[model samples]
Target chain A: MSASDPAGAAAGAPAVAIEQLRKSYGPITALDGASISVDTGEIFGLVGPNGAGKTTLIKAICGILKPDSGSVSVLGLDAARERHAVRRRLGYMPQTPALYEDLSPRENLVFFGRGFRTSGLSDRIRDVLEFVELWERRDDPLHNFSGGMKQRASLACALLRDPELLILDEPTAGVDPTLKQNFWRRFRELKERGRTIFVTTNMMDEALHCDRVAVIRAGSVLITETPEAIRARGRTRVTLGLRDGSLREQEVLAYEEEMPRLLAAYGLSDEVARISVRRPSLEDVVLGMIAGDAGAGEKPAHGGAHGGAHGGRTTGAHPGAGADAEDGGNV
Target chain B: MFSNINAIAVRINRQFLRDRRFLGLSLIVPVLLMLLLKYVLDSLPGLARLGVHISDYAILVAAYLVHFLAYVLSTIVLVRDRKDGTLGRMFVYGYRRREIVLGYVGGYSTIAAVQTALVLILTKYLFDINLAPDLIAVVLTMLALAVVSVGLGVFISNFARNEGQVFPFIPLVIVPTALLSGIAIPIDELPRVLQWCSYLIPLRYAVSVLDGVLNQHRSFFSELGPFLTLVAVGAGLLATASLTLRERE
Candidate 1:
């Protein structure tokens, strides 16, 4: 509720922490003993495939879903026991923009602000609308707005309370590239203001923007590490052009050692013409991990705070998109 | 809690006001239904020879109109709200189940209030009933019925997942009230088992009380017994509704 709110939370507590959280819908398990932690003032991303419990985890963090077992702590308060108190400290934007289609941006702001009992109503509404570049569209109804415009309006409502922690579920799913960039810019700006952000996105490039991302599959976290560290673990592709104009490609976890060993085996240095190397992208690495684990029931290799072993490092490329390509799930 | 309720109420009222067509229809439908009811009731054989004017039954029609319309309107709106994720958004933003049910009841009360006033005034003018003497009790009874209808709507909505799912419930609720609530058949004349089940219908109490003042010429205070029962049912429905309303998917 104030500039000092994030700091006012239980001192030294992480923004979010979940331990062995499990949830089920009838016979289908949504979250299977998933554990993760998010530090304050950092942008954390949760990456997963469809029906992989990305949303269920987000809801647990927001205190909207009670885990079948285990615990969730938000801002140092128990998520289930202190749901109301937890809600007061955070803002949640659902996968879809949940604004009333009949109400204008300004009216929506007023409604949410009143719900939060926010102070300085007029000033707060103006500031949020302007922050989201929605001031010009203040009086326009949401149903009349374009998709990106509706998103902006929804974001403005979420920020009305000046929440210490903001949770966005696929905030840029259908957003154009330019607006997607715009949204990340706003998220970073909020980050600069010392607010913690928890975003769930499957887009590889979007995952790159986070301080760290946790790849989840079948309700368990396959790995949690910095993008750079995870990227270092994937194999690099090497393409070779021979004197006869034939091109050969090879993938290696360590190109420095493997490339030379490969060339020596060919026994024809004079025949080598050209060479190019391409490292596996985050998407390729993620899909490889998920595929590797989906049918094998194999435990993901141990990973340290920096980077260690993760089983998702395998072969396969997503069709249509380049290895490193991003998808906004365009509308 | 009060402020949260007020915020939700204001937002809903704004939406109601903006859709002028829906608002106009809400007020007009009861009047049209009243005329239709009279047309059909007038056709019942031997009523005119028995010296009972068909218009004399307008009070019963008014009570049913309030119950049916209020229940249908509230149920549909709540189902739509849940489908749109606004209900989930509110829960994440700290709105409790009780506050949500109360807030909606508060919001829809705008339409209910105006509709109550319109039906009572039209019942007096169109039916030629001597309602002036017991105006306060009669109006209170009608308004309480509207409130109870709204509560029942909220309760029933929890059983439906989407707008399409509310269809089966429309007949499931409306038909029982129409047949067993004493307007179609006198309550005492029904079998004892059926008579006991009529007590479960809120409209039965409203009809009993409304009949007392409009036709039986009973003093207003004498009708308080059934009126209190109606209020008790409303309170019970609202509380059960709050308890049943899901805070999570």
Candidate 2:
């Protein structure tokens, strides 16, 4: 991360800026004033559990759904007012498979190409099809395509215009492991071409490859940080990974107060790695915070102007947010 | 707006052309239904008494074929895309909701016009029904009726969620509209409220327009009012359908 890197400047350029985005369906608050920014060419990930408002936020940005309050700007244009311009610059791959099953992949590409107002369309079509490795099956009816193949064609259609920003919602869901790896590799290739990608996912390992990420849950974004920073939340949790059957009883005893010194006395530090007592993962961090609040029958021990702003929970302002390692629990 | 409209037009055309079975049905189904109606009506004594005039039957055939094709196919196509996610993707791709509605209506109207023309020609030459009021008024009426039927199709598409749900609306909309339009029934003999419905149904004017063109000594304007009515109904339905496009399914 160079301080003034070109990519950094682009990432900081505010290709997409959301300020206090709020949406609701009667009583269900879909987006509770969530705010995030993406740089011009960075691949930013929005990872969260189900019903976390990722889809709602994406829909609002795409101009499919109207936000109740707050603002969304894409590439310096307001999404609601300049929807056409925003659509021209952005390519969206919806979570569901949206292609016409009766049409061949080539036909589908041609239709979408004409929609994007692209030139040299046939050549571009062949190029994108080849790029996605779906050229071999271009003539097959989409109804005949397997899930992975359909997804590839869907992506090919989205890339027809060489869009500046790509918003893919769970692009690899249900894809096999090998194809999933290929998909991520293709995403990296796209990033190298100076394209900004905004993706939503729940898989944490993939988050490691993202330049930055926002971990959201239940319509609220919990944290936004790099994978390294998130993992560094505490000293780093070390798992014992003990000899399978041999550790069950010991694992139960390790939770006991007297066992820490006893395990140290065993001289098993090499085989038995010490648990550094770190905060759980981004996923676990969110679940744990919510769980702790539920158990304590109180708020997250954090409440201030910024602490609970926009219906989101933030760390307390007093005592320096409790050393930044207090696991966000009042207990 | 026009580019987005053109995009949807191209998609609808490509979609119809790609499916051989659907294309065949689009071309053949209405003609077959016209022939089936002729046979069903000939068996009844009352319709048989309209002088057994080949020309009257031919005009009715032309009207029904145009009405059926416009109403049935448009609803099916629109509802199918809505059920799938293609409509949603199109919205994301810079297509204004109004363009989508207009595009489909325009495309379907074009197909219905061509098909109606062929049916009229077949009835005139092959079935020996005379063309009395020239080709121009007949063409105008067919086009108006087609637009009206397509409008009804667009309106119904908004309410259908899936293919299975779509077929039921066909009877609910098409049957009553067809029956009340005076295509299969005589409007004068019906009750007063039923007569008012005939005014509401665009096909009533369609049938009237056809009867005027085919029946000798009956001035086309005597039925000109119906032709104008069909056009007005179509425009009204189309406007309402366009407004509904702004809503998400």
Candidate 3:
């Protein structure tokens, strides 16, 4: 279900619920009235470009940041007021690899586990290291590990507490594709074990693995929908390669009706060397939404011209409407 | 809270153990300085004439060296933790700010204890420096100086953005405090205005307490004023450091 679905809200309290969180660094508003909800036992992806407030939102939800206004609740506890209790149930891995360069993976786990007051830490450390496939080299200092290995080690630290809600920021940014695939597999495995995952990433491909994705830009959430729903908003594009090494593209909402017309218009002529239909991906939908939002003159909600002293007015666009129209052209 | 402090302390100690060069340097600098002082004093004609025995200066120098080393080590480690996101990571893990500060204290204080003991033993055997009849008082005084150093280090670390920024603090904070705290010259020999300024430097109280214990053979209770002042200043600096700690901008 979408974050805004009333039925989902009625079913039970979400694992995380942020309402109009506003935070600013002088003139730069990091989070401008940002809001979203993540259901329990679901993997929620916050997809955004750099400076899109994804990290800020994650920090607020994790109780690392105190919003200037509004409220944040994690597992029905106020994140800002009841921070210690909320933090106990949440595991957070920051965007940067936060492991000590001189310490081994096991040592890092031991430190974090003790900080979280976890028991049977030695066994848990071994299990997490093995899960991340770093068991063989867990004894080596983190400085000797490759970027992917460091990322995996950081993930192991986050999992040391066996938290019910895991918040990971760009967990696979520098990781190899194979390791990224493995990380996703592990995330899915954790989900099956009744855990809720909130992850942030700029990679559109990564969002496909999440149960729901929130498209954030300019410190505002553009839309929240399932991967399939977001893809549905994207239209199929027909591209024709010409002999002159140039290409002509037409986006079609109804492939059956528009495909015939476009083919007939172009005909089986020598000028058109090849014609292919390309289905829209999540990238297209997200880009289309951002373009549409920009065209609509939506000021950056966080830390832009309208973000600071004046205070941003809530400008909630109809979620997914502009994206659907922009993607399908005539849907 | 204790568990969190212990865990962080263990992690910090492990990091120190892994960097053997730093550990070695921290332990050896004071000994080298003490040896250098011995040779210099033996050659100088005015030391005996001035009634300034090398033994009297040895305890003072040892106290100052231990304080300086503790300050440098704690500042570097804390600033590195800040720059590298370790401090932020611990904050995310639900560690209170005071606990993290205490963890640094616990870790560095352990090293300080070792360094103090080694310096005391080395001064006695290697330097042939005469010790006070009450060795425990001398040890307690040096440990207090170490605490002051750790507090000052952690406090100064908050102002430093990176490791490079930490260097300027040596000249601006350490050098002036070392010179003014009567480590090199007695406070009575300083200019009247400078003597007044030394009161503001916490190390002055530490040196005073050490002198009282080592040179005078005074018990801890006899040097209560300076001892309490040293402890108070260290506690004040640590409190400020904890209050200023923040995870992010």
Give me the candidate number with maximum TM-score: 1
> What's the lDDT for candidate 2?
0.71
Q: Please, what are the lDDT tens digits per residue for candidate 2 over residues A87-180? A: 8878888887788887888888777666667778888888889988989889888989899888989888878777778889888877764576
User: TM-score for model 2?
Assistant: 0.77
lDDT of 3: 0.78
Off by over 4 Å in 1: A1-5, A8-11, A254-323, A326-331, B43-45, B50-52
Q: Is candidate 1 or candidate 3 better by TM-score?
A: 1
For model 2, the stretches where C-alpha displacement exceeds 4 angstroms are: A1-13, A24-29, A231-264, A268-331, B1-4, B45-58, B125-127, B188-194, B216-223, B247-249
Task: Choose 1 or 2, whichever is better by TM-score.
Answer: 1
Model 1 per-residue lDDT tens digits across residues B44-69: 86888888756657888788988999
Candidate 1 residue lDDT tens string, A45-122: 998877889989998988878678999999989989998888888988888888899999998878766765777978
**Candidates in descending lDDT order:** 1, 3, 2
Local accuracy of candidate 3 as per-residue lDDT tens digits, B68-97: 889988998899888887887888787899
Measured against the true structure, the TM-scores of the candidates, in listed sequence, are: 0.87, 0.77, 0.82
Error of 2 at B61 (Å): 4.9
| lDDT by residue (tens digit), candidate 2, B1-249 | 787677677677776777888878778876776666556655676745756655566677677768877888888778777767788788776566678888887788778877887788777765577665457788888888888888788888888787777788877876777678775677998899999877877777877877766765476777778778788888898888888864442
DockQ per model, Cα: 0.67, 0.53, 0.60
